[model samples]
Target: MPSISHKIQPCLWFDSQAEQAARYYTGIFPGSSISSVSLYTEAGQEIHGRPPGSVMVVAFELAGCRFTALNGGPIFKFTEAVSLIINCDNQDEIDYYWHHLGEGGDPAAQQCGWLKDKYGLSWQIVPAVISDMMRDTESGKAQRVMTALLRMRKIDFAELQRAYRG
Candidate 1:
């Protein structure tokens, strides 16, 4: 297969689990793999504080989207402000992601189909139908769908469809 290239990729910040996180993500998503890895050198020991040969960065692709994980110390942390969205085609796909990504995460953070993974990275496991429901501008179906969405942690596509019809 030809190599896939991306002009823009999201860089995830981690304290010391860049490689581990990359592996975990690749395992969860299909068509994913660790493309490359880079390690920190002793030349920047004073600034980086990490021992030489420690993992510095891992470039990975998940479901065809490229991402870079960097072990840049604990100066920054993942927040809910930015999240990756996984557009699922069915309830099975939604359930699979919710179970895997929501593992070891804060239960309270699971709302409106948004979940925090074990690595503290936020993800939105949304069904494709939600988009179609939300895009109906002529009818008030969009508002109804939003109301139904606001009431659940994990999205129920069937419920959203019912709401759209109402």
Candidate 2:
């Protein structure tokens, strides 16, 4: 186990892919890694109903944000109501994240830069400027940008810029 500093972090529930999910997430983001892993022992066999030494939880960090993935069974699942938002710097950044995160994900779940990864985790990949553009309602540029955004699955930063300019 590595030394932990974060007092609180998002805990993600998984049926059996806690370690795999942690590795996958850490691989995608720079300055990220798995810090620790705890395993179920014979002490909890009656309740956990698993072989001893099975993975129970995995602690990881993505771009400095800490998260915990638990093999807590399939009683719960990820829904679109909760999502991770990645605010990108440019079109290239957007494209890079979209490609890496959306790969092997459900195609039908993508809309307006939002996607569901293979793990059924929802994510919104968008240019940071989109927030500024969408907030500029005083000039009505926000409406134009929103209209352009509605038509996109993987947001095109260039297109949003054009809509904002108009």
Candidate 3:
């Protein structure tokens, strides 16, 4: 198979924590690292107001997925509408991501395996089984799973499995 180069990458906007967020994310996931860092230049100082030589953008990879974190000032902030989904194979993976990502996060924002990380980036730490369980359209198993899923903050794979069986 030919190696596919990714054309589109998600760019995360941060007030000034692009480098910090990149470092945090690289530390959390395996096979992740900061590939490059671009500093702000004097040419755009008036509009950007950021000091020259300060971090402007950080290109990083988390678990093989490329991402760009931009220190674009406080013009915009993260919302829950867009979230990065982490599909885990089992409960252990779920717990690990939940614990790590939820640190310094808004507790109220955590629902149905969805959470806002410290940088205000939304994430869904879900189990792989949830997708299989949700695919059962013939019976009301999917509905049951959905009901069970709606009640929880962090996803419980066992509960979803039980809901699927019912």
Candidate 4:
């Protein structure tokens, strides 16, 4: 068998909603899809001779990244230690995703930018110029932008630029 190149896979554990979540994610993002799904069966010896046919796993992709959702019976849950950062070009894009992803989610109060979805998934909705502002070598401009961003949950590009000017 040929060895596959290295790829990052985010393994997600769900009680039984892996498929539903996968479809929801694919719908929310462009260029996203759920590739495949595999179910489980009691092919081997069971705890008490139980029959097979339980959902074992679901493998899919979201925004070009592969993820595996396992039906592990709710032993674990998701946390904020890991999150997806989306860099947006405008408020419309930010609002669209923020609203969609946050359908059953939570908002972290960084208006215009940071929000935690109902699933406890943390996302950073930022503007395109943020990179330039943060990476700028000019200390004064960078400092100003940084200060402005520190106070915002949702990143506002216009305010960041105003801060950069100061």
lDDT of 2 by residue, 1-166 (tens): 3566888789999999999989998999988999889999999688888678889999888988999999988889999999999999998889888999899999999999999999999999999877788898989899999999999999998999999999
lDDT of each: 0.91, 0.92, 0.93, 0.72
Off by over 4 Å in 3: 1-4
Candidate 2 segments whose C-alpha is farther than 4 A from its true place: 1-4
Residue pairs with clashing backbones, model 2: none
**lDDT, model 4:** 0.72
TM values, all candidates:
0.94, 0.95, 0.95, 0.80
Mind giving the per-residue lDDT tens digits that candidate 4 earns over 42-128? 565354232356666777766667777777665687776767788788878877887798777865433446777765667777886
Local error of candidate 2 at residue 153 (angstroms): 0.4
**Highest TM-score, which number?**
3
Per-candidate RMSD, Å: 2.1, 1.4, 2.8, 3.3
Per-residue C-alpha lDDT of model 3 across residues 97-144, encoded as one tens digit per residue: 999999999999999999999889999999976788888888999999
Displacement of residue 87 (Cα, Å) in model 1 is: 0.3
Give the clashing pairs for model 1: none
The lDDT, on a scale of 0 to 1, for candidate 3 is 0.93
